[model samples]
Target chain A: MAYQFDFAPVLQHSDLLLTGAAFTLALTAVGAVLGIGLGIVGALCRAWKISPFDRLFGLYVEVIRNTPFLVQLFFIFFGLPSLGVKMTEWHAAVLAMVINLGAYSTEIIRAGIQATPRGQIEAASSLALTRLQTFRHVVLRPALTRVWPALVSQVIIVMLGSSVCSQIAAEELTFAANFIQSRNFRAFETYFVTTAMYFVMALLIRQLLMRLGQRFIVGRPR
Target chain B: MSLVKITGLHKHFGANHVLKGIDLEVAQGDVVALIGRSGSGKSTLLRTINGLETIDKGELVVDGAALHDGKGDLRALRQKVGMVFQQFNLFPHLTAGQNVMLAPTVVKSTSKREAEDIAKEMLLKVGLSDKFNSFPDQLSGGQQQRVAIARALAMKPKVLLCDEITSALDPELVNEVLAVVRQLASEGMTLIMVTHEMRFARDVGNKLIFMHQGRIHESGDPKTVFAAPQTPELAGFIGAVQEA
Candidate 1:
C-alpha cells in the first residue's frame, strides 16, 4: 500500500521554516563578507610570504582545508567552552562558517595571484608605484576576476554547509525542518521544502555574485 | 653636461659576469642605441641604469642620484627615469587612459582632472588619442606599445629606456612604434634603446655602442660605426642581421 501524502501539517509550520531560512541567510551573509575579507588578507600573506603571518595563515589553511566542516563547528560550539572561550550557538556557527570559507578562498585567490605575469610587476615598479599601491591597483582585481567562478562555488558550498549549524541548535533552516518534522511527524514533506529553499538561495546568490563581478571586477563599459 | 655617468660598473649573475668594468657617459639630448647579439649584456647594462638590476661593484649616477648597492632611494631615481619594455606591458585591467594616469595620480599626487589632461596629451603625442578608453587587449600590438610609451611619458621622465621596444612587433607594425620613438628622438628626449633595427639606429641614434662579451666592443658615431667597424665582433653582428 502507498503512504498517504499530506501538506496541511507542514504548511501549518511555515512560520518556523521562514524564520529558519532568514537565520541561515543572515549567517551566510555575514560569513561571506567577513570570510572573503579574511581570505584576501590570508592570500596576500601567503602569496607575498609576508613573514610570520604567512607561516601562521599557511598552518590555519592547511588544518581547516584538511578537516571536516562539521568537526570545526563542533569544536567551536562544544569544545571552546571547555577552554574558557564561551560563545552562544549562533556565534559559534558564524565563526565556523567564516573560518571554513576563509581557508578555502585563501588558496583559491592565491592561485590567481600567482598567475600574474612578471612583466606586470616590473611595469608597476618601474612606474614608481609602492608595493602596496601595485598590489591594490594592478594585481588584485584581475586576480579576483580570474578565480571568481571558483570563489562563487566555494561560497555556495559554505552556504549549504551551514545546514550543519542546526546540530548545534542554531535555529537555521535545517533546524526548523527538524523541529517541524519532530512536532508534526511529516519528515518527508518538511525536508523537501527545506531542500528547495536551499536550491533557490544558491541560485540567487550565484546571480548576485555574477552581477557583482561584471560591475566591479570587470569594470563597467564607458 | 652629462645626464648619466657610469664608472667601473660591474654586475654578475652567480658566476656569469654580465657587465664587466664598464665606463660610459650620456649627455643631455643624446640618443644612444645599444646593439649586440643575445646574452651580450647590453640589456643588463640598460637595466642597471634603471635600477632594475643592482650593480655588483662600481658607481651609476642618473640625474644626480647614485644607484649603486644601497645609497639612494630607488623610488626617487625611478621617478626621473621611464622604461618601456619589448612586450608593452600595459596594465590589462585598466583603460589606456587609466594606465597612463595611474602613476601621475598615485605617485605624484596629481589631481584626477590634471592627470586626465596629462594622459590625454601624452596619448595624443603617441597618436593614440582615440584609444583613451580602450583596454590593452582591445588594442593591437603596435597600438599597445604606443600606449605604453604614453604611460611612460606621462611621468615626464628625464630619460627613457627602451629595451628592444619593437622586437616583439610584427614587421609591418614595427615602424609605427619606431616612428613614435623617432619623433621623441627628434624632439630631444634623452633616450637609450636596445634594438636590432640597424638602419633606424643609423638614421636616428647619435651614438651606437656594440656590446659583446659584456664589454663595449665598439663605440662611435652610428654612421661611421656601421660604415667601418674596428672589431670583428661588430662586423659579424652586422653580417648576421643582414643575412637574416
Candidate 2:
C-alpha cells in the first residue's frame, strides 16, 4: 500500500494556518525584544556585581535553567493565578516565553561581558568615561557581537518551543495544525506542513539576525 | 612648576613589594624616561601616577589636583592625563576615527562634528589621516600604535604616559610610533615613558630615572645618566639592552 502524502487537505484551511503563523510571530517578536532587554540588564547586574541584583538574577537563572521549560510555562500560565496574579492565556504565554529566553540570554551576554579584555576597560576608564558609558559603548556591543550566533540559535529554539502553547489553548501554529487534524482526520498531512513552516521561519530568523548583527553589533566594515 | 608629584609612594601586591618608598617629580614640558629591568617596578610607578595601580601608602598629586581616596573621583585627574598601552588597545569594533573620538564625545561632551574634526586632526598628526575609516585589525602594528597615540591625544591631556608603547612593534615599525612620540615630546607634552629603547630614550628624553628592586636606583640628565652610571644596576641594565 502506498503512503500517499496530501498537503491539499491542510492547505484548504489556509486562513487558520496564516492566523496561527501571525500569532506565533507576534509572540516570538515581542518575547524576544523584552527578553533581550531583560538579559542585558541581568547580565550587567551580575557582571558588575550590583549586589542584591546580581544575587537575585543569579538565583533566577539557576532556577529557570535547571527546570523544564514546559514546567515553567505552566507555572506562569497556570500557577500564578492561584497567587492572585491573573493573566489571559495569550499574556501568560508571552510572559512565559520572555522569562525563559531572558534567563538563557543572561548567561550568554554575561559570558561576553566577562570575556572583554581588561585593557579595554582600563583604556575607557583612563579616558574618564563613566562606568555606565563604558559598559554601554565599549563593553556591551562587542560582547553581543561575540556571542550573537549563540543568541540567535537560542531564539529559534524558543520559537519552535512555542508549539507547547497549544497546551494552554494559545491558538498558535500547533493549535491550528491540531484543529485541522481533528476536523479532517489528516494528522500526518497537517503536522508535516506545520513542521515545514517552522523550518522556513527558522531560516528567515537566522537571516534577519545576521543582517541585524551587521548593521548594529559589529559596526566595522571589515 | 612640577605637574606631577609623588612623595613616599609605596605599592605592594600580597607580600611582593612592587614600588617601595619612591619620590619623584615631573615638571611641565619635561620628558622623563623610566629605564630598568622588567621587574624593577618602573611600569608600576608610571601606572600609580595615573591611578592605574593602587598605592598602598603614598601621596600623589597631578597638576595640583589631589589623589582621590580609594580610586574615588579620579575623573578630574584622569582627564588631565592620557595613557597608551604597548598592545595598542584600540576598540576593535570602532573605526580609527571613532576610536579617537570616543573619549572626547562621551567624557567631554564634545559634539559629534567637533569630535570628528579633532579625530581627523590628531590622526593627521600621527600620519593616519587616510585611515580614519579603517579598523584596528586593518592597520599595521605601527599604524595601530599611531592610532592609539592619536586616541590619547584627542583628549588633549596635559600629561601623557607611554607604557612600553613601541616594545610590542617590529623593528621596522618602531620608528613610525617613536616619531609621533618624538613630536609630542618636542611640542612640550609632559611624557613619562617606560621603555627599553636605550638609544631613543637617551637621545629624546631630557631626564632619565633608573629603578632597581622597586626603588629609584639613579636619576639625572639622560646624557650623564647613561654616560656615567651612578649604580652597577643601571650599568648592568644598559649592558643587557646593548647586547640584545
* Best candidate according to lDDT: 1
Clashing pairs in 2: none
Could you give candidate 2's per-residue lDDT for residues A44-137 as a string of tens digits? 9999999899999999999999998889989988898899999998999999899999999999999999999999998898888988999998
| Candidate 2 lDDT over residue span B129-206, tens digit each | 999999888999999999999999999998999999998899999998999999999999999999989899989999
Q: Compared with the real two-chain complex, what DockQ does model 1 have?
A: 0.80
Residue-by-residue lDDT tens digits, candidate 1, A62-179: 9999999999999999998999999999999999999999999999999999999989989999899998899899999999989999999999999999999999999999999999
Q: Estimate the TM-score of every prediction.
A: 0.97, 0.98
Candidate 2 positional error at A193, Å: 0.6
Instruction: Give the total clashing residue pairs for model 1.
Output: 0
Q: State the TM-score of candidate 1 restricted to chain B.
A: 0.98
What does the interface RMSD come to for each candidate? 0.6, 0.8
What is the per-candidate TM-score for chain B?
A: 0.98, 0.97
